[model samples]
Target: MRLGSREVGYPHLLAAALLVAMLVGVGVGAGTSSSTYGAFNAAWDGGSGIRGVASDAGAETQVVYNTTEYETVDPAGTVAFVISPERGYTDAEAARIESFVRAGGTVVVADDFRPHGNDLLARLGASARIDRTPLRDDRHQYRAGALPVATRVAADPLTRNVTRLTLNHPATVTANESTVLVRSSNFSYLDRDDDGELDDAETLQSYPVVTAERLGAGDVVVVSDPSVFINAMLDRPDNRAFAAALAADRQTVVLDFSHAEERPPLQVALRALRGSAGLQLLFGGLVVGAVALVARRGRLS
Candidate 1:
């Protein structure tokens, strides 16, 4: 084709097509995400803030897409964050996590309004259980009653420099065996009926929002609300401090997304490509061909 007295060769046209296709692929991969709590998601409710927090604390951060990776990771210097899993964990997967914790790995289970969290706790033989009921505070709240503030922070490594924690639609943690690190104010009450009020059945009292318990040589820290580590809530000073504390002294921080509802398509595709030698070779050949086409067109020009 002739454009303003210049001829566009077939090689040039083919190279341009390849480049445009590559650019479109890259754009689509970056713009699409179905995950809610995905570490790669930069949206408000995503856990991307916690990933930055871990990286800022000088910890090597990674995301675990499969529970099989749990067996390969070194437990001694690692901390795993299992937050708001929408899917239930398998018996073997739960056992794998339990073994990871028992073998001296720190596992932080931050969940609310999910039966899967309690199920995993039971599987791990943890004494702490997450109450599914939503805890609301009328007095010590952030912007609304649903978003309560926990002023009672205990002296612990996880609660260091954290005077108050802001929670979002959180549940109360009940633990007879674990050490309570943070608690809601006495004005907080469990919204059993979801009426958003202090009803006749509900009474205002302090409830545990964060707890830590020792299992073997490792530790299991449970946060009643996973949203505390999300991008929206991490803006709160105490929440950010609390997230930093989770990665403190840990060499590796892992965001466990094995049980999550959605996984990033780009990450999934990359993992699949990495595992297949044929795919890699194919992509390499295509890249080489595209370069060769451009070089040939330049020579012809």
Candidate 2:
């Protein structure tokens, strides 16, 4: 009365195929909608090992940029902000931003001491130092592990919701009369090698991790740790609340996609599609095996 493996597997395989088809249909629908903002949206959806605070802020929140290829702007009431990881700025772009801010635009600059982020720092009237030394802190270490803390901030609108902040593998910023938003305790110092490994004996001086300075007619906020804004890290109450507080009052927010560089959309899409395909194949194989077994049993009976 026993059925061979192949004979039992067919029906099970057919069921699996049907299930996979249903799932794929749902996935495709979700992926093609305006709601899907691609990789940046994925990063905000808690994918980039950092959590995003603005995900729940509103439905209209979007990422903006000034790259030669794409410039996205929303006419509705929403926040539009630029994100740049570059160290230098082109003369034309600088003038455009300066003019925008002079007209009461708000720009949040996030960088990690990379050369790409330098020009933005200079424009903000601050200098950045790539810490070659490791920072150690006994007081400010996260549950995951210890991280280098930077300068503390004075009271300001940008940091109003942020009482304490953490920066993982961060660079340091120094400026005269700069309002320190969050700082590493005296126990913490910069880890310059940036190997994510810190040593007490090799500690450098404690410095600012996030700071804000007043520029001509607008304001500039600088962050040394980009990890705070990533999807995984942004979920932390402190980080999320801080981001919400930073953008709470702003009417328009721009997320600069210029720093994203160039990558093929089809390649990304194919990768996503592959996951669905694998599931379909697995389901089909299981169904076929089950059907074959059932058929063999019927024949024996």
Candidate 3:
């Protein structure tokens, strides 16, 4: 018996629906996996954004956190990551992060300060004291012709692949018994208040901006300022190289998605699920749906 047009089209519609369901199922399953989730965040002042972008570029699995909503986001593993302090971390949250690090999980805290003074610095076995004096240098200069600018590394894995880095009126950082991956030049000194004036009498010598420490079975990396990896600055060659290196061998990278103003778990999941078969299926379903709709309407006129 010859089937009517509506009846003939019903199979295509059913096929399309089934394809969509299958795709969604695959996507949901893939999204739930550890390899398919990326979390990150940007601070209100744009410091965290730089750092977050650098980290995201190099991470296999990353989460960005810049808002309070992410505080409740369940970390896939033992690590609780915070990229920038633009959103600020409470004492309790810091304690939790510390616990996560101690439990053989990595915590990367990037901010400006001395090696041991800053609260996060202390947690990472470093201190952070702002150098309220201007830095003097003939080698590097800011856009405003300021001297002794803070800089990132080109040879280190954490920063070697980072092509660009942002530095908000940053202060040089210092660390003890930790690996200093990046440093300011000798001519550079801290200008803590950022008044565009340097005082040799009040200057603190070249300090560490980024450092790494080993804690128990895990490690903590601290950056003096969060601006070294924002999206705006990431286009720079040095920052991009540094970011790539940092993300190179890591199996799971977290971005502290809780820190961003917008938290989209699905977006994180899709990015993380880049190479998954489920993603392939999802795309395939989308193509199939489009074709089916087109075919259905083609014969309508």
Per TM-score, the best of the predicted structures is: 1
Off by over 4 Å in 1: 1-34, 276-278, 293-301
Please rank every candidate by lDDT, starting with the best. Answer: 1, 2, 3
lDDT agreement with native, every candidate = 0.89, 0.54, 0.52
Q: Least accurate stretch of 10 residues (summed lDDT) in model 1? A: 27-36
TM-score on alpha carbons, each prediction:
0.88, 0.62, 0.55
Per-residue lDDT of 1-301 in model 1, one digit per residue for the tens? 8854478899999999999999998877664554777788888877788878988999988788888888877899899999988888889998899999999999999999888888888889899999889999999999899999999999998887899999999998997799999999999999999988899989989999999999988999999999998898998759999999889988899999998777767778787788799999999999999999987877777
Candidate 2 — which residues are off by over 4 angstroms? Answer: 1-52, 55-59, 67-88, 123-134, 144-153, 193-205, 262-301
Answer with 2 or 3, whichever has the higher lDDT: 2
Q: Is candidate 1 or candidate 2 better by lDDT?
A: 1
Model 3, span 1-301: residue lDDT tens: 2255444567777898999999998766544323212222232333334334444554444454333323443333323445444455566656666655666666667544323236655544444333333344445544642423545453555565443343544555456677777776555655555555656554534556667777766667766555455655544436555555555555455566454444445666565466488877888899999999988787883
Clashes of each: 0, 70, 75
All-Cα superposition RMSD per candidate: 3.5, 10.3, 9.8
Query: What's the lDDT for candidate 1?
Result: 0.89
